[model samples]
Target: MPAPQLVWFRNDLRVADHRALAAAAAAGPVHAVFLKAEAQWAAHGVGANRLAFLERNLRALAAALGVLGIPFTVLEAPRFRDAPGTLLPWAQAQGATALHFNDEYPLNERRRDDAVARAFAQAGVAVHRYTDSVIAAPGTLKTGQGGPYTVFTPFKRRWLATLDLSSAAPLAPPDPQGPVRPLGPALEEAMTLAGAAASAVPAKLWPGGEGEAHRRLTEFLAEAALRYDSQRDFPAVTGTSTLSPYLSLGVLSPRQVLSALLAAFPDALEGSGGPSIWLSELIWREFYRHVVAAFDHVSKGEAFRPAFADLPWRQDPEGLAAWKAGRTGLPLVDAGMRELAATGWMHNRVRMAVAMFLTKNLLIDWHLGEAHFMDQLVDGDFAANNGGWQWSAATGTDAAPYFRVFNPVTQSQRFDPEGHYLRRWVPELAGLDARSIHEPWRYAGGPKAYPKPLVDLKASRERAIAHFKAHAAG
Candidate 1:
């Protein structure tokens, strides 16, 4: 006769390491809910590809929850329209005593959860929130000064010192026998979870489910993980684990990832060199999470480093369209853009390349490119996308200095040397030799009708550096 528990699932979509699920179930019989906030999805700029991934993963999660005798309910709404208000009533009718959910760090999620917690508290219902996303919050890792560290290198160094290899192990599977209530099969009378007609996901891009995530990690740890530090630079190579989407959606927990990493390479478990490098990237993801929280101004689209606010941005529709459609006339940049369009993903090396092209070369605001990427990337994480764009534009905390401009041709030659990546994305250049493919302007009638370079590289580079210098000197 004890009150039931309600676990409102958000990004933490898996069952293996779910603290919220565990706590709630221990307290009482557990019921689960998945909200499909379509309006909020649009406002957050969640792309079609990512939404598809979420839908598939939610279904996978429902199956897992079903095995535990937990009834799964999927609610679709315009936005947060009634989430905070609706949850109290829903939990009451379900005979729930408390609401449990994993922590979500984005601006909107925090607002939603805070409001819901207050509402539930007002109704005399308890709420429990768990942190399963990052290993630790950003403020937890700090310098001797007792303040948040803005620089990544120092933060990464401190992160290593604060580590205990065994404690951060992945969550063990829980006992399924804790509490069971047979909901029986969904009756014909039960309301169906309505959604937009599901679409086919591109196979070449992301393969869904936590199972695929486990497979990817195991495969990477076996062989590809060693080369992750070296060959991750080449877009043509499958050097990097495509784990970002799962991590973003909480299909795979970061603890699970680090556990695999440490077990595979126990010698450097404290972190240094290659293991440290990858770990730093993971921390970067965490850093941006707090950056979005600490600086409400940033969530509002203000630069982390305010001096760059005066940056002169171009208002060129043709140029922006060219860049978006991969007709920027810069082969490497164009190729990177095209890859993003095709796969809803792009390699990290060239992500910086295309980002710099938009912000530095074309003088467009980095947010413009950031928004576009969010609209397309299947693994589009707000923190990573914003951090990357702002970093490349030299407008973020621990961001690169503006004077450091990336030359498209030189970067391509160094990273994608054989033009293999460029050729793969931009097929018109497929027939060309490596040298010509990178900077086609050098060859006569380049790429058989591909547009010529949009602007002179030398002039643009000079302009970018001069602009940043003038801003700094002034």
Candidate 2:
């Protein structure tokens, strides 16, 4: 019998379309391992919600791999730096000749992977890395000047032009090698530890697994996708596909998503309306990943644009507390924040509104809001969260203009005109009329339970603009 090829599972968990797993199976008999780096994840602002989701997905992954006759092991490594120590010894003990894993672009992850590669090399084990997390591998798409794309529009154009749908089809899971490998005690202990910490987040809201992910994709394409362009912005409607948690954790691969999308609408790339709009969103996600890889400063918590790095951001613990609690007294923004707190996910349009409220109106630092989201969101992905907060704060590539602060009241009126969304999330103001619901402060004898507006939107918008202008001038 040949020495087994070990597959080190990282963010990409699913069996189908898993390049590293496929490669390992093709090489020889395969075994899989996942490092439970709890401390490292916590340090990165990953909260209980995402951890719990990860645990659920890990179990599902184990089951899927078991069907393929691949023995899956869960090992403890409190931090990424401990990975080489934890994994190298295990591989050597198993007499594994080769290790395979998908690449992660973040600075810390890249460093950890490099260290593991070196350790394995010293131990006489070969390492193979695959780019499976993203649709386009980071740094692959460059500008005409041979620089990494900083802007999204041009990058999307290049991505579409270069992409060959036929060539990018998702790979099938490898044929079963032998009898299914029974799980060990480590799996149960890992689940217990993860479950104990994840009590705050309900498991029913998000059923983890590749099956659920594909089901969602199919459902969204069959029912809501046609109307996604019209209804996506409205929070009350189930117009958008709630696939972020799966996508973030690699329970679903981008290739599988694209394949399903193209199957439904062959002309999705060039078509107008919902398909194209959603495709652009997927491109935006890719663009952010590319940005994180190309610009090391972004992953290091620095602004993408240097000019906004030192923008005299205000420090108000009370204001920040209110924003986190969804008591900012701005209907739309509060609703968004409350939704995030309650469900561990917020609608995309509302994410923008709340983010702008924090960075622009409250004048709090974008990093604080970014951290809050990371700590609260089940689908919290570093690249997407960082990119979004930076974009909202006008500190990133293709960011909203400094002067363009979203008026939360106007936004509520436009997006949730019927107040269905606001009512659902902010029940205190549910009794108020649609007009007053948007601006609760304006309604006399309205809900006393609801707090007054945190800041005068007009004055604060002006203040934010003035601050940006002053910084630019100086």
Candidate 3:
């Protein structure tokens, strides 16, 4: 009899379109393992909300793995270095001849994976890695000059040209091994959260499992895809797919998402309407991941454009606290922040507004806002969060121009229109008319309980631009 194959779970929690799991099962009877690296998460500044979300998803994943005759094992390892010690001995005990896992691109994750590969190789066990998370692996696409493309347009052009639909289609779940025992409660117990983080899970807003992910994708394609481009910016309208949480957790793969998309609109890339715009968003996610890998400094919290490293960011704890608490006095920014706090999610357009308010208007360091988003967001992937903050702050490759600072009031007035979104999140200003809603500060005593503007918008905007100009000129 052949030795059993081991499939190690990380962010890719789903059983379908899972290259590692599929490959492992094809080789022989598959067993699965998940390491509860809560200590590692803490060290990485991962917030409690996301941790709770992960726990919920892991429970779902465990059930799915059990049905496939894979005995799921959970262990605790504080950090990446501890993984080999935990995994190697287990693989040997399980009589596993090979170890398999999907690739993760972060610096620490890469280091940990490289270490695991070496240790397994030393133990005379074959190790296999599959790129399941991204559609195209990083560094595969390059410019005519034979170098990585830093700008998004050329990268996207190459990406679309290089895309092979047949290869990117979702894979079928592997055939089950018969008469396997159901998973025990041990794995579930290992994943339970404790302390304040335990209460932060947005259980209703985000249900775990691949089933929920598919339901969301299906619903979006069926009902919302046509209007996605026009209504996505409006926070009140449910124009966007709520699949980011699933995508970020790898409950849904980009290929699975693209399959659904193409099914609805075959010519989505060339056609106008919702499909085209939404496809662009998916590519943006891919671009950021690629950028993180190609430009290693971003993972280290350094600005993509080194010149912005000397940016004179303000130091204000009170302002930071206000922004976090949704009391920033900019209606749209506050609303976005509050929505994130309540639901572990925020509308994409509002995300830009709040990010800009923090990094440009308040002149706070973009890293602070980036870290805060990662802590609070259920869909927080480091690459996306880091890319967005840096872009908003004009400190990243292919960033919004430094002079293009967002005017929060205009953004709210344009997107919210009648202030429906603001009313939903900022109930204190609910009584105010639409005219006063966007700029509540203009209202008498600012509509009762709302805080006054943290900084003069025009003055701060000018200050940010001047600072950037001075640095550039010098």
Top of the candidates by lDDT: 2
Better of 1 and 2 by TM-score: 2
* Residue pairs in candidate 1 whose N, alpha carbon or C atoms collide under 3 angstroms: none
In candidate 2, position 323 carries an lDDT of 94
> What TM-score, computed on C-alpha atoms, does each candidate reach?
0.93, 0.98, 0.98
lDDT-superior candidate, 1 or 2: 2
Scored against the true structure, residue 469 in model 2 reaches a CA lDDT of: 90
Against the true structure, candidate 3 reaches a TM-score of 0.98
Ranked by TM-score from best down, the candidates are 2, 3, 1
lDDT tens digits by residue: candidate 1, 16-104: 87778878877877778877687787887777777767766776776677667677776655577568766777788887889999877
RMSD of 1: 2.6
lDDT value, residue 357 of candidate 1: 85
Colliding residue pairs in candidate 2: none
Residue 160's lDDT within candidate 2 is: 94
